[model samples]
Target: MEQLARLEDLPTRYVADLTQKNLVPLWPSLRNVLPPLKPIPHTQAISWKFKDIKPLLIEAGELTPIEKAERRVLVLANPGHGLENMRATSVIYLGMQLLLPKEWAPAHRHTPNAVRLIVEGEKAYTTVEGEKCPMSHGDLILTPSGLWHEHGHDGDEPVIWLDVLDLPLVYYMEASYVEGGECQPVTNTGTKSRYGKGLVPTQHHIRAKNNYPMLRYPWAEAKQLLNDLAEAQSQGPIQVAYVNPETGEDCQKIIGYSAVMVRANETIQMSPCSAAQVFHVIEGQLELQIGTDTFNLEKADTACAPCFAQVDLINKSSEPCFIFIADEAPIQKKLDLYSVRERN
Candidate 1:
């Protein structure tokens, strides 16, 4: 392939005049904006070990009070995008948040959609729009865009959760902002009890449904479903998508969440997709091969892969391994840019 002309190839006076007029040549940078075969993604495959982050998170809880910090969190920033950016992928933001016992994080609503994957401890609950969703190991709680939510811990130990948000995308669009509010009166409990066995509340047929009908996805239910799927199928990866029970669509508009279970001594090659993906280990251990890099992820650990990267997950443990996945598929599909390359 022939190389595109460089900016230096142009005459100095012409370049100077173009710059003075606040205009620039496109030919010199055309290839960068329109790469030949695939995008040159800035997101690289990287892993964050919980063992290394847990201590720091605990120390943060001791150093900062809930009133001062609001939400004490340590961001899991990907180096490829520059650590200062605090981004896990092009669109995903990953952070490990800590809530010490008897602490409360004030109610606030933000424009960027976010979810919490409970990583450790219990007796903590997130109140979202008047619904109190309890935090449990491996459980997923949604704090969608513009929803008033706050955190409270009742247990003796510290509560920590991995916060996955579409902040970078919202911030890039200049639409990200937060509004603080007083504590909300708990008007409702988690709605997961009303959804099961492919069934939803009968009221949906007669009345209008809430945009986010279910706020909490318990890990116990998801794990049992994964187990049933593994037992029912002899081959292929066992995975279940976390969707909105009312609309039967992706839970959020920007990011899609799923749970994948890898059987003992098994290996699964994920199809290459156009959207970048994040993998958080829920149970057991697994070895992840993202493109050319390999990472051994333990419980509560997290890893991310760039768009269109070849990913392979291997479970060398004696027990089944479960992982929580977050990706840019929902927004990509909305924009008509979602694609999966066929394996050659």
Candidate 2:
């Protein structure tokens, strides 16, 4: 019997044959279609999560305006960088968040501990729980898991900060809740200067030794400290460490809470480490490569590199740039830092 048909008839018959045989040819419909992107396999039990936002811009195209207006966000988890979605537990979230001079994202709250490393800003504050915490350039603030916070700008220019949260983990736990502020620019219950100020000596558990009654990290002091430290390490890699204001200890926002220092054109080959690393570039530019993808992160950019991703850094600017980074740090301390030549 002749079952021959024209080309248009071939596809339907092929699908029918596949269905009958419990198999799928897929080639015809998939010839010009894309295969789903696969998440890379981890060697050990641990995994890594890092991204290249530039190539992602090229691949995904510009972010739509509605997206920008809703959350005031300009990027998404792109396939080019292996970010599955906000609900992907093993993934990390990173982006360049631009907040205008008068932009005030009304108060909202959620679970999953988060941190912010200010990229550039002077007169901004994120009132957490109920207290307003003043923000300065390069300051790091913590909004512990499940806390309500709001952002307001009273400064003269646009204020921007990096926002990081444990996305999928929060979703997986079924503990993520987001509620808008009571009203536009809802005022806090108490000001950071009034309640959390260093002047007050009421709460011991929440207060670090350096915990001033003030709810702010001053930039004037931070900038000077970096300048002095860089001058000392001028011939080599520079480091301006951030100790807890209250305890003068490392890893206060959990573990590996500190800012980093990098000079122009300097390249750092991060040693094999176990911490889930996060970075916000406060100044200068950097070239970050994970596997085959590369990222050129500039001021105001942020990244969260999970523990397993082998990492490398290349400085492309002319002056020193400070980088704000937080991570679990090398669990064993043996592979926390390394040289690029060694990685190569």
lDDT of 2 by residue, 17-45 (tens): 87899985554445234334322322212
**TM-scores for every predicted model:** 0.97, 0.60
Model 1, residue 66: what's the lDDT? Answer: 82
Error of 2 at 217 (Å): 3.4
Candidates' RMSD to native? 1.5, 10.6
lDDT string for model 1 (275-297, tens) is 99999999999999998899999
Off by over 4 Å in 1: 201-204
Best by lDDT: 1
Which ten-residue region of model 2 has the weakest summed lDDT?
Answer: 41-50
Lowest-sum lDDT 10-residue window in model 1: 198-207
Identify the candidate with maximal TM-score. Answer: 1
